[model samples]
Target chain A: MQRRLFLQGMLGVVAATRLPASTLLPLMLNGCQREPLLPGTLLSACDDARGNHFVASIQPDGSLGFQIPVPLRAHDSCASKQRDRALFFARRPGRQIYVVDLHERLLIQTIDAEPGRHFYGHGVISADGQWLFTTEQIYATGQGMIGVYRMSQPIRRETEFSSHGMDPHQLQWLSDGETLVIANGGILTHPDQNRENLNPDTMQPALTYVRVRDGALLESHQPPHHQMSLHHLDVSAQDQVVVGVQHQGALTDAVALVGSHRRGSDMQWWMADELTQLRMQQYTASVAVDANGGQAVVSCPRGNGIAVWDMQTGQLINMLDIADAAGVRRQPQQSGWVGTNGAGALVRIDSSGTATALQTLRQYPLRWDNHATLI
Target chain B: MKPRFVRKSRYEKKNRYVRKKMQLLLLIVALLSLAACNDDMTPGQRWLATTTEQIRQGYQQLSAQTRAQQQMADAFCQQPDAQGLQTMQAAWRESMASWQHMQWLRMGPIAQDNDDWKLQFWPDKKNILQRKMQDILEGSEPVSADSLVHASVVVQGFSAQELLLFDPQFATVEKFAGRQCDLLRASTTLTARVGQKLADAWQDETWLKRWVAPTATQAGLTPAHVRNGEILDALLAQIERIKNDKLGEPMGLKTRDKKPNGYFAESWRSENSLANLQNNLLAVQQLIRPAQGYGLFQYLKDSQQQALADEMVIKLDNAQQALQQIHPPLTSAVTDAAQQPALQNAHRALGELATFCKQKLAPALGLTLGFNSNDGD
Candidate 1:
């Protein structure tokens, strides 16, 4: 009789608390009983930031792979190989792109981009491998733009696209095949002064989509919420989009929506877009969509956690605190990473929510602008 | 059948609920522990605390005395004066005494009973000399040349003072007294040998012979090639006197010579009386620039000992510059040599090197004057 009463009391407390699932699911995922479906797996990681150029592969069993030399200096990041040709970017001297032969891993040609122009540096290649898109920040006038480079031509032709907002950082490709999505990271500037000139009072954040069938912008989408500067974005196999936002401190910004597109007409923002105001201090630096597009993960480096959202439920499912989430990446055998920033690390999260770290990447301590791309 | 079935169902339901609650509590505890254990820590602090203190202590235990001795040597080298030279010689003796003792300590009994005589004579060398004295007491005087040769091994480890103090044939008063020119010559040779050994340690041999001759007794003699002719006559004539003496003469043999004033002076002047001999002996005594390790006679190898001299000169110049930077510079009166722009700069630099060697490196290395000097005397 006494044990029954005790059990009843516990149930009563849980029901009355109405505690959020997000506050509890993280505990379950990070606990020992939650066995990783693919434990100790590895992946390839590379940091093409500095003059350091090397590739590290993590095996399926979590063993570190030998470092393979990639003949490029300060590779910002790498892109998927197109017809045995891979593309990488470097910053020393000036911002430029190099096309490399994947088998030989050697640069065969270089295309110089805008010199003396400050580039925010994250870029992605088109699925057909005919286009390369990168972000550019013009410090002189505090204006930012998207650079669309045509790689199909004998000489790479660059077409400048103005960022819907300032300080664009990364871009993603939509399943529609004709649309290119971008994160216009809202960062203002004053070169005449220092970074101290960032006007938090007058910053706008937006996520843009451009219809580019033959390389051009079409339509776009914005959360009608407030200015939550989206910094990085990724797409899942199921076509769900994950966006990380650096919100300008305001009560309305915190309520930005994140979810999957159920249909062209039913595609609406997450309902959480109305809870409270968002602050820049709560901004995140990384975000990725799960392989199946059922989940989205956003990393708050300062929070040391990856905030997970369930697209199916339109609910914030979990937040995995990995101590150093800034260095974390999605792996096939695990849901989150525990690594360092600017360190080369490749991670993949599979359909079963298993993260597999491809390999440990060497910190390419180069002297230039750097970014990463999916290979 | 109905009552039994109902009772069993109730028990199963209670067990299931209890198990669920227990599982939930365990899960919560596990989560809390995981969160606690994953706390972050700052890096580069592990090796900071103890290693830094150890490095500081290592630096503090340096030998300052040897550095001071180097300074004294530099001073002697620069001044080439009687007192500076004597001080250096004394310091050399002190260093040799300590070094020999240190070797004795380091070798312990391993250096004893090594029938190889050379090796055995290292630590118990004093005993070897004592043995020789014992033999002498048993009517074995002058210790045989073979035994003397064996004793030389012990002598190799002797300090300068020990070499001078160890008198075999009661020659201490005769050979080292005011009239004992042979001991004076021997002393001069030992002083030079100390400097030579220092050079040898530095792997410099070209100038070693000039500093220390093969025979310690032969080093202080006048150059065998010096001629007494018109030049000698002119020098002697200026004195308005005549003297007589022979190198191979007996102790009392003498010839008298008279001056124009009819004053008759003794034929052989006392060892203390011959001004030239005394002056030469004093010069040789004052020239005892004893060095240690690879540091002695370091100046001699310089394109004229240019390396060592330049080191001394440069350091002194820096020190002078440093001194000048002081609000009120060091109150050193500028000498005539220092008045010349170049010489002045050189002297100032040399002085700084001298002070640095003496105050810093000497004690740092635990090196002193003749760490292993006094051999072959």
Candidate 2:
């Protein structure tokens, strides 16, 4: 019930009630101004009409909250355990991570990658919020590294561990919290090459599970096809992982691009109807499991559709036509999902296969980026 | 040397000249600003609006032809004669021709609910259609249009009807004793119903609004830019399919070490594979330079790339002409060595056209095709 309340609160909380900047000046001087938990329901890296990059926040009601400008475009973001702040990481080849203090509605810190490392544009905070783990790669060798940071006074980088694969992109927390499940995309790319896949023919992608406390490799499994690069995923309360694949081969290669794996089991791929497969187009942007873990939703931005699957049976339940679908996440107060598209529309997705525009989403001249995070 | 009165007049004349110049400058600025904020459709936008209308009309034709086909099938089933069989096949071909003309390059109401596939399912490499159709014919229950609503896509639409009408084993009126007529009437009825649904779907104004204006301005995105790129992408993509799947695959150019396999060809049972390929290219030609209104051809001309537009249309013309030069019954044509060069020329023309679209047309329009839609994470 409390979690539901938290989700509902994210949708709207009267942004007009925010204290004026003048009233908070004295508190800032004292260096002790802590406000509410992250002030918005949805957080994403967006670009404005003028092409300026920003780490933006929007309420459940689709009202704009904060737009913290950043130097480079960022990717997926994860809220801190305390919910007081959130971190947005720059995409590969970028070494900066922007930290936004939700209460102050300001970008409080910019964390730089260790001298020789760069981020893969994804990260997750521990359940207790003690540590922040990020996907990164050693620049010179193209080796994947998991950069661990102790969430201390200055948020310093403590150490790192090998990702056990190449081009690790997005990671999620298992039910145990300390166990991180990562999608090792396995495509070798150099930062200087401008996002080129240097080893497509030889790439080996995998879904891997690693222990954060000791950096131990618990389990690892490669995709059925060597060219099936696993990129983004989300884990449920049952530790069931749903991952989205980006195939680096012919478009007509009819391989399943979304699948699930529970530890110690073979991966179960979700197959859509043949027509739906045509719409999926072999690329997926995000994978989100609903609050109940009974359903999995994947946004196929390339195909401009969203597909939902029955978690237990791994069968497709519904396909929603959403043009340029960017990200999907479960609603704060219910079983359905909220999806954002590239056309600047927010759509509410019901498990019954009906997709409707979120009527209250205030129109903005902004394109929602590839991923969305909840505060 | 002039008098004081003459000097004053000269100064007045200079003042008048300066005022006139300033007014002309102001007028030019006002006109430029209007151009910047012009609500008038760009050449690309005009093409999209025109194409949308064209798509609606095409769907209407499909609905009408399919309805006529359903009626013709019922008439033939009641009479069961050779003449009736010929008439029924002609109606089926016309309906299929209408469908081939649609060539939806992207999403719309027809694409939203799997409606398009319910109307026609093709490229059956595994012969799922025949297997399912035979199973249905061998079943206990009497097949009807309502029953097919929930049936597998394999036994539905034009492909199933083709098996019933054209395949030698199923084509005879004597086969009606085994419920062949029932399957034909049911499949044709279902086809007509789905076609009508597609036509109805295209009438929604809300859908049209979303289809045309697709992206946010943060990327300098506009309706014309998005729709025009998709049209070009779809045209190029379908032509590639025709060159490869429809023509090359059956020719064994990409499979079985160059041994021609006629069974792989679409509409092989009906022996209309070559005709289908021609219709597909005709649809591509219509989109590139429609008979009426501003098409992609006009858009190209506005961008000062008329030569590129002409090259694409010319290439498509060459492809269709080459395809037409081949013999009937694509199933046998693939095995006839004499027809191989024509097939190869047609295939080469299609490949070159697709390359021109991707390389030349895209840049000339100041658009990058499939940036967000096809970009992988």
DockQ of all models, two decimals each: 0.00, 0.13
For B138-250, candidate 2 gives per-residue lDDT tens digits of: 89987888998778766788888999999897898798655888889899999998889887776655555565665433235465565565566566567777877788888
Q: List TM-scores for all candidates, in order.
A: 0.37, 0.68
- Candidate that would win on DockQ: 2
Chain B only, TM-score of each candidate? 0.20, 0.86
Clashes of 2: 1
Per-residue accuracy of model 1 over A159-229 as CA lDDT, tens digit each: 77676667666677778766776776565754344333265555666566666545444544554544555
**Candidate 1: residue A86 lDDT (0-100):** 51
Question: What would the per-residue lDDT of candidate 2 be over residues A223-282, giving only the tens digit for each residue?
Answer: 888999999998887889999998876554668888899999999887787667756767
Q: What is the i-RMS of every prediction?
A: 37.0, 6.3
Off by over 4 Å in 2: A1-170, A183-207, A212-231, A245-284, A290-295, A301-303, A308-318, A329-375, B1-45, B79-86, B203-264, B302-348, B358-377
Q: What TM-score quantifies how close candidate 2 is to the native fold?
A: 0.68
Whole-model lDDT, model 2: 0.76
Q: Give fnat of each prediction, in order.
A: 0.00, 0.17
Clashes of each: 64, 1
